[model samples]
Target: MTANLHLIPLLPLLGAAFSLLFGKRLGKNVVTLVTCGAVAAAALVTLQMTFILHHDLPPGGALVDTFFEAPWMKAGDLNLSAGLWFDALTAVMCCVVTVIGFLIHVYASAYMEHDENYTRFFAYLNLFMGAMLILVLGDSMPVTFVGWEGVGLCSYLLIGFWFDKDANATAGRKAFVVNRIGDFGFLLAMFLIFYHTGTLKYSELASHIDGLHNILWLGLPVACFAGLLVLVGATGKSAQIPLYVWLPDAMAGPTPVSALIHAATMVTAGVYVTSRLHVVYEAYPQALAWIAGIGALTALFAATIGFAQRDLKKVLAYSTISQLGFMFVAVGSYVNGSSNYASGVFHLMTHAFFKAGLFLGAGSVMHAMENEGDIMKMGGLRKHLPHTHATFLIYCLAIAGIFPLAGFWSKDAILGGAFAAQWDVKNAGPVAAWFAMHAGKIIYGVMLTAAGCTAFYMFRLYYLVFHGKFRGTHEQEHHLHESPARMTVVLWCLAIGTILSGFLGVPESILPESLHHFGDLLGEWLKPVVGVQLHEESAGQFLGFAFVATAVSVAGIGSAYIFFLKDDGVRAKNFVATFPRLYRVVFNKYYVDEFYNAVVVRPLRGLSRILWKFFDEIIIDKLFVGGTAAIVNGFGKSVKYLQNGDAQRYVVGVLVGMALILRVSTHYSAAHAAQFHVDQDGHAVTAVPQNDAYTTNVRFKVEWGDGQESDADSAHPRGLKHQYASSGTYKIRLETTDSRWQTTASRSETVVVR
Candidate 1:
């Protein structure tokens, strides 16, 4: 069974390869069936693997199956091997990938059947699924990045799958370019780790932390830098901060792609990365704090953006971002010295169920509308598409965290983790440390506010799309048939997951000791990876907290129910008419997008244009590039004088050079002799003195005009050969006058040696 785990992701990879290579010859329906069948087979195999894992592994055991390693790379001391890790986290993630992915693929087959590009869509979908599965099951970060980049490439292809449409192509490019921003961070972080640790293997890096952290000044700073880089990667993949602009636009693709990538699979990579690096973050709480802060802000920001969206899928996109924000919050809470791995991973599971359902239901709506997605044009759909309406209703309640549903369980668990994180600070009683470490009053407040907004906006979308009378033209209304049985069947299955998945991580308070046994199944399973902690909140406190959280969620639902479902006037008009400014602000998402466009995008474009015009074209050409040309020309002209080829002028120049050299040499030698005598005898040594320190003689062979050699054996007159017994100076003089034109010319020569 352990070895069989390798087959899970491989099946989809094979299916993708076959579909892409021979899909056109196979025909669209065959392609769809083949891909779907392959993924379904993979899901079944994963199910068997999970069952075996449950039966075989102990409470805190991980089943690591390294089936193959091709020795990808190895340097002097660094080695990285490609393998798979099918531990608790991998098991849970694998189930989600194959299961949810299979559902989405099935839904897409039916939803996309009308399109001519159905075969291509399934190929991309399978490829994307395989890449994501590999990402989760990878044993090391490099292996994970391979899958990371694979998914991004698949997303760009899928998002732009309908490339004939300009908007769709632009949306695809946006997803690609924006994600690159985060991928850059991931690459840089890998380099930093490789430089310091000399290895990229997760096990080796984990064990060598002490060595890396030994230089607090160097290590801490580098750790923070690396962590921040990884977070940037997370933000891009997960759609945080500036990177989130692409997700809403991503709806330009088919609704099913949006559902699969944005809701269930790709965006969650950030949270997965953060969790995988829990140890790295544990060593640096400050980085974790930053993570939590950014996540909380993104949640609130995207939720607010959801309020203003008119398109159904765009609203869900923002909603996905907001929900991901919660995951980040859970991760951040763990960083504050608490163990909320169960809570964060718990929320991740439940979120997948509900979000995937929501997206699929949205797809069904679009399918019925002849491809229309705006909620304003889609009223009175509940009665016609009863299955979609019913499934979507359950998903809405779950997502709104309504009582007893899966969303309520998972979401409140997250809030409970947030509260647990801030317990000591808020309690201020006996558990002061827990309170101080965990309490984030401001974060909780914002989260609660976002929760309210989520409830209101979701119900608003629900009512606008399903509750009112049909608003489309007669022809459009005539086409409003239910989605295919294949789509509906998957929707129902996902609705069940949305309804019951939370039970896997059931709060211990709900199922007391001896039977509070959900703990060992996932909590203990993930203990080796996420380090689960058995929460000790009293049963009474747990009930009280659950009750209050449920009450608040219901209140949000009730408020939406009254405003949209009951009072139809509020739905037609503005609910916040009394405060037009506030309503407008809420509708505009506080203009964060506009601000980013103006402040960030505009300036970047302007600077890029300026750089292209000035530095790249003008300065670079003129100074760095053109200057070389100028220097070459100047050298050519200066060397032209040497090419005159006049032998007489060359001879005169050489004689002048010889006279200058001899005069300079005589002056330097006399000065040296004078200095030696000045230092010892207070007089000059006019001859080569035997007692002097100058002993060795150095001779030069000179070349004169027209390549003629000077006579080396010639001796100066009057013992003026100038030899020094030691290292000192002497002068050589040839009798001559100082006049250049007296009779012929009185020649003189001066030579010096030392």
Candidate 2:
């Protein structure tokens, strides 16, 4: 596993490079063949690994990373490794990604064969798979980000693959920009992790946190901030509130690209990031609570929007957003109460299968209908594409959470996790256990209702698309046909995955304790690396299962059947007229996108305009230009004063200054002479008081009051000049115990000879 881990990411990258570079020369068939083959090979390896893990699990064994490195990204004490891991979680994710991704690739091979940019399309597709694989297999937060940003890049490329269409290009740009909102949060959370634990490597970070007592002012705040930041990233990537508009519009791309990126690979990156960092979230349960609340709101919000959408892809796009919200709520609940990564991730895995199947099925219908995506414009095509219809029906049921299907099992597991999280009364301390006992029922009810909403909209979408009269024109109907065999095959494969993938988290009541094993195996594999216990619901979890599973599936399908399958003509008309406001609100998608444009987008653009004007015209042009002019004017004024020529005035000033200097010099010399002292070396000297004047080794010899000179060794120094070392005129004075000395005669003379 270790030896081949790095190869997994590298293989798809090479395939992408090859297809992009030589796709034109090689042609669509060859390009598709090569890229699909590379991913298929990777899928095969992943399946083999899954089987190995399955066998190991039966024997109560698990797998971990074979090897990793610290890399060179060390700063201060923080250490992060740009390494990869191949534990059970990564292994399962790898299998899901490669297998589903490969199927989509195959489907796109035939679906996109006629398109002009076929090579570029496959290039983006392969790049997305490779990046997604790396995201799952990363051993550290930073490594995960590399994969994260990589997937976003691939999604932007693939979404805009058909650049000829303005809408397609716009959709691609929307996806790229919207996802940036989430990516920003993710990056901030990583910074928080680095700041706190000083390590981003899962193993080291997990090992360092212990006893849970370290969570106080520093630790708790950091944990909360990190969790929230990561949730923001999750919201953006998963298409949660305020950041999800791009997904529905993303249908502008080719259908297979839509299925590949929206369903299986790109959008679900948030769920993966949250689940991967579940351990960090556990330390800040308040943040987890917020995650659940926001997730629930988004789930309902998006679900309502799905009900209103006319476009088949848009409905599924909202559905994807809604379903991802469920996953987030599940993860949040797991973190706060149960620590059940298995359930949340189990839902994530099964979601990829069913949602991918659904999206691909939608694509098949669109292809059969000549690229029309609106359900309102499609109908009665079940007869034309039996394989696509059947596969689509299975996927529809699976997403609706019907029993024995993959979605039912995974969805039930999430509800169960949510139930357990609300009140882990059985194991927690006394105070916490007591609160859980009181609030548990309320929390459980909310999650269960969310599940019901999930079923309703999904069925609504199914009814509109697959179970109706042909609403398209005669010419459009003439083009209706089954998807090519290659495309149908991919649909069937995904249908099977959607139907069977739930066994990974099957409820324990149906299986023996020994066989009730999947969650524990996966939990054990992730626990050491994540530092959070993965919990299974304690008891009465089956009641939650039965209630939610039964209510949502029955209510959702019965409504759909009544409205679309039976007497829909009268019922829909009556229902719409009776509740026009409700219908209109839902139909208009609650005006959320419109409101966002009016409030957020419009304001932001206005602010941007203002900033541009202020910076370009006001600051840059005016302040700088005006300041330079002022400086130049000041220089002109200052230079005027220097231009005056007055040599006679300068000479008169010099003569007056000389007279003042002579008077001050004589007074200072008299004051200093009072403390004069003589040395034995025939030189005149003076001893100045420490505070008043100065003391020196050599003293100035000066002429006495009557122009008489004193010899060395005298009681007081007489002359200022002690010796004629060189010829120069020197000022001389004498003093004997007086505050001021007066000169009897003043003479200016030059000492000519030594």
Candidate 3:
């Protein structure tokens, strides 16, 4: 079956168009219906297509549906089709983006009901959904980049939805500019890939992998160079480390938009893209390690930063970044002798469930607390918002990796894969072996710590907000109430997902021996697409990692309870009092943003000012735009003298112009532009004349200047020969004419016939 894959994205795009065009006239209710219905309908279509992909398609096959018979983009050797590619990987992403997007849409309908731009909000949401689906389903990289830029544009619009607020607008611009920086890397990688291989379709690129295998770019292997550039792009989209500053600020948008971005769309794009193009990374182990190291570091780094965040959304924002890092680690661990891409994607799924639920819960909390975001000011609201509290607790526990929850299974898959990693240090020097031997363990250890931090900050957010006495003002306290059914219904549904989603990916080693057949169905389902891991795990190794994972999760949760809730946070207070400097630093996000502002943002702004002054104002404006105008005006002034009612001067000018034109047209030139060979001890010469232009039909002749000449032979210009009597210097003459134009040109030169 063709699967009619284009309709999946088409539905939402149409909805966005309708919402933007006629939404105001139709009223908010109609806008909401079209918006949510479109995405919901797309989700249903995605489910149907996914079923078809799973049951009907052969292994390693796709159900492709192109929009037109001809290529959408064709230039010289480049041809790109407008099409949808349906495979196991795309199937998984479609479910995530469409399903989560639908939920966020439904939630937003209720969340933004009172907003003035409610219709516009839904329009942006639908647009975002459509673009993300395009990103997932595009048949080629250029097509994918269309969606890439589409989402980037939507992110700016959605993040700055409240344009009235200066900070919100700045945050949106920040996301745009930072993502552009990362997008440049993606663009460069595409250029390099296309340079080595003529096509950009995923299947075609895969087939042409060997063509790029041994090629080098800028002193590095092509694969390595491309892989590094790809990683740079992933870090920006996924919010890993240096490019991560934009995400925390993205909370300036509506909460539902935040859920959509964090769970469904933009952030997971990086991990998905890497998995989609794993062939590029297969030849470069160091590049793969760069991914793992960055992931491990970002996970730990973000988790540590999360510990000090007071705003509920900011905490989850950092938590999102940290979890994304874990996904990066999962995808990047191929060099560690494992291709746990399924685990990485699996984590993306589970994170969507728990994190979206968490963010929704935060939105719910904010709604009840009268829009208060700081958890430090929130306490004991569980009594008031019972449903929100229950779902929030579930999401919190799930994200903390409590057993039987979604996070545990996926996090366990990644860790198990990490532990099973085999470093190839054979035939290496001692230092190399030492580095290889310890690198895997070090990464594993950092991920473990990050996992622990996940539990710590999540529960810290939960306990601080839900467990203590009410701390807010009377007016805010009076406002506390459970959210409307429209919103809480989504919470409970996602809460159920947080509880049940993990079982689908339960690794066999974590289960009893009899349940082995039921375990890792996700891995089995995805194997045809992502392929099997590089290193196979023994039961003992997997089970061992699972055990440590549970222990660390429990320990982190326990630590949070003891420090923040057990004794009313007195130990936390004492610890903070003792380490105020450290606490302040972490609380301030290590001043990385400030550092960036000082080093990057400020310098760039300063340089931009210089460019605006010198380049834009002076060079472009004065020298180019104004100078052209000035030259035109001055030429007009100079030429007006000829038209000063002076018929005599006008006639002279016209005649002079005609003469120059005639001279240029009648110019003539010629050359032998031919080939000759000497033979018989330089006694004879044969020549082939390729006369220059205008040398037609008259004749072609040559004099060997050895007292011999050849007859004119324009009709048969190939052979007009003269024999040289001996090996010695001589003068040679060539002549040609165009009798019709009455033009003749000739050349003579000294020659040696030897």
lDDT of each: 0.70, 0.67, 0.79
lDDT tens digits by residue: candidate 1, 257-334: 988898888998988887887666665556666777787777776776666578889889889988998888878775
541-624 per-residue lDDT for model 3 (tens digits) = 767777899899998898789877878877656545644453234424434434423442233334434543563346544654
For each candidate in turn, give its C-alpha RMSD to the true structure in angstroms: 15.7, 19.2, 10.9
Model 3 score (lDDT): 0.79
Q: Model 3, which residues run further than 4 Å from truth?
A: 70-75, 168-170, 335-338, 422-430, 510-514, 533-535, 575-754
Q: Which stretch of 10 consecutive residues in model 1 shows the poorest summed lDDT? A: 737-746
Model 1: CA > 4 A from native: 65-72, 168-170, 217-221, 335-338, 422-439, 512-514, 519-521, 575-754
Worst 10 residues of 3 by lDDT: 669-678
| Alpha carbon deviation, residue 117, candidate 1 (Å) | 1.7
How far residue 605's Cα lies from its native spot in candidate 1, in Å, is: 28
The estimated TM-scores of all candidates read 0.74, 0.71, 0.76
Off by over 4 Å in 2: 49-71, 74-80, 164-177, 210-220, 335-338, 423-440, 512-544, 575-754
State the displacement of the C-alpha of residue 753, model 3, in Å, after optimal TM-score superposition: 42
Tens digit per residue, CA lDDT, model 2, 1-754: 3335667777888899999788889877788778998898888867766677666554323344434455465676654457676666677678778988888888888888787777888888888888998888888887888899898877777766666655455455455656776888989888777766777766566554432325555535567778889988988888776566667777777888878788877777887777777667676566666676676666756665555567888888878887887777777774343355666677778989988988888888888888787777776777888998899889878887887788887777666666666523334688776655444344556556555556766776676666678789898899888888888888888888887786665655556777766544444545543444434554465665666577867886776666555775455554445433542344245345344224422333344335434532354334433444567789888766544567776676688789779777665553443433333233333322212333222233346333456433233333344443443333334333322344322223322231
Model 3 / residue 612 / CA error / Å = 31
